[model samples]
Target: MSELVVAEGVALELRPARLGSRAAALVLDLILMAVLYEICYQLLRALAGSGASDDTVSALDIVSILLVAVGYPLVCETISSGRSVGKLAAGLRVVRLDGGPERFRHAMVRAMALLFADIGLPITLITGLPVLILLGLPGAVAVACSRQGRRLGDLLAGTIVVRERSETSPGTMPMPPHPELARWATTARVEDVPPGLILAARQLLSRVFELDRTAAAELTEELARQVAEHVSPQPPRGVAPYQYLVAVTAERYRREIGVNDPSNGTYRAYRGPRPGFPGTRTGARSAS
Candidate 1:
């Protein structure tokens, strides 16, 4: 079978998550807030009954609100590794714009920003409608214009909320007898493989069950050639064509196969028959 090679330098796909996911998160947050509000109300009432004054009561209310604001993000980040309860339930997370995990400071800044957007801005608009009418428009506009869907706080903190992609399953592709041959069977990381190649490989692999050996072999060979050309300057090195093909195939396999299993070691051997090869030379070789 001809091996499939992915193109170089493909842009990644990034899109806003579905409205349903966002809505679900919002609903969950509201429910949690309601519960907390009731608890705060009861606690404040008890404190007043025990001898607190009106001023104390008002101060406690502000403290309660602040606690809610802080708790939401802190709890989420600690429990779900940077995802709010709502985000966790919806399969979303707050990440840096660079696609890295977000820090607590960033999460806190985002949460505080959201609090201001939801509460402070509304209050300001109510108290000084004329001023808000003239100047508040820009604040809202700034948020909409920013990339990464960041608002003022998000922009300042360098954070963005994004939907998480599901992990690839193990043995998603058929196992090749040789590690070199199997390499072609494996897919590349989303960042490494071009979008077009990833899409093409997926489409081809999906219909692999229907393809005859001759057809599959032809497609694999053509794909291998393309990969060789794209990955040139670092193409597989060996004396024989089969060995070269196996070397290339192994690289692809590492990208595609997500499972960690004992069979992987055996399969790696069959892919290439070259001596002194990094993976196959040292370990147990599979029967060709």
Candidate 2:
């Protein structure tokens, strides 16, 4: 079976996030909620007075609680840029399904859904059978099952929650090299190049490489065509396909090489030793 892979700095085997992270996020949220509830309850009681009618007092209580439920997520998301206070504290953020930044609408939907999932069912249980509480269970389960730990609300809103990692921890691995010929080239031995050069090249390749060979070739070909069309005069003679590939790859490592020519096509130049040369160590040459 074709495996479902989640790439990190390196291609690691996919695994579900630990439930502890979710629990921590929920616990933090509950603490904030308790504080909000206490403040709101006190304010409502003071406004209504002890002599207020039972109906009036009950209405005030419900309104105060509902307001807390509805507004908490919205306020948190808005202020923290798509992360609730709890999620922020827990080092997590909600992102669009496409791996882009989260938008306000998604935040709203997710916040509202969270309130319903966390509060609505309990309220229904107080007034109805125990089984009624199960209505919200699915929402929680959906979150647990999602790749990004997204709840039903997140799915509905086209969002996902991702944990934050330090800069040292590779955030997202660049797309893998194309599975066919491109993969062969990318998987080439690192020993052939300087350590810094190899690392830089890998970083560039990560961003542009794809796991599918056909797609990689198509992308490279299109890029080559564009370069051929755009440049006023063609590249100097003796720039074979391999040389061009080196040039393109080197260009992607812009910081190291300090050259930017989109017309050079997707490939960048290599600052490392020329290809086909023997290295100091046998293993190094073997790797190349």
Report lDDT per candidate.
0.49, 0.48
TM-score of each: 0.50, 0.53
Model 1 misplacement above 4 A: 1-12, 18-20, 48-50, 118-147, 165-260, 263-288
lDDT of 1: 0.49
In model 2, state the lDDT of residue 207: 31
RMSD of 1: 12.6
For TM-score, the strongest prediction is 2
RMSD of each: 12.6, 12.9
Q: What is the per-residue lDDT of model 2 for residues 1-288, given as tens digits with 9 covering 90 to 100?
A: 011211222232212223467667767887887799889988998988888998998888888767787678777776665677777787676654433345578777876776665335555656685744564466667765765565767767876555543211332323222223232333333222222222223332443333354443333333333333322233344333222333434333332344433332343333433323121221121111
Q: Provide the global lDDT of candidate 2 against the true structure.
A: 0.48
Instruction: Residues 1-288, candidate 1: write the lDDT tens digits.
Output: 111222221123343333456557757876787688779867877877868888988888878877876677666765554577787788766655433356677877766766666334555656775533433243345545644444565576775555554311122333342544334334422234322233334434444335555454455344444434444343223322223334433344445564443235644333322233222232232211
Residue 252's lDDT in candidate 2: 33
What number of clashing residue pairs does each candidate have, in the order they appear?
20, 11
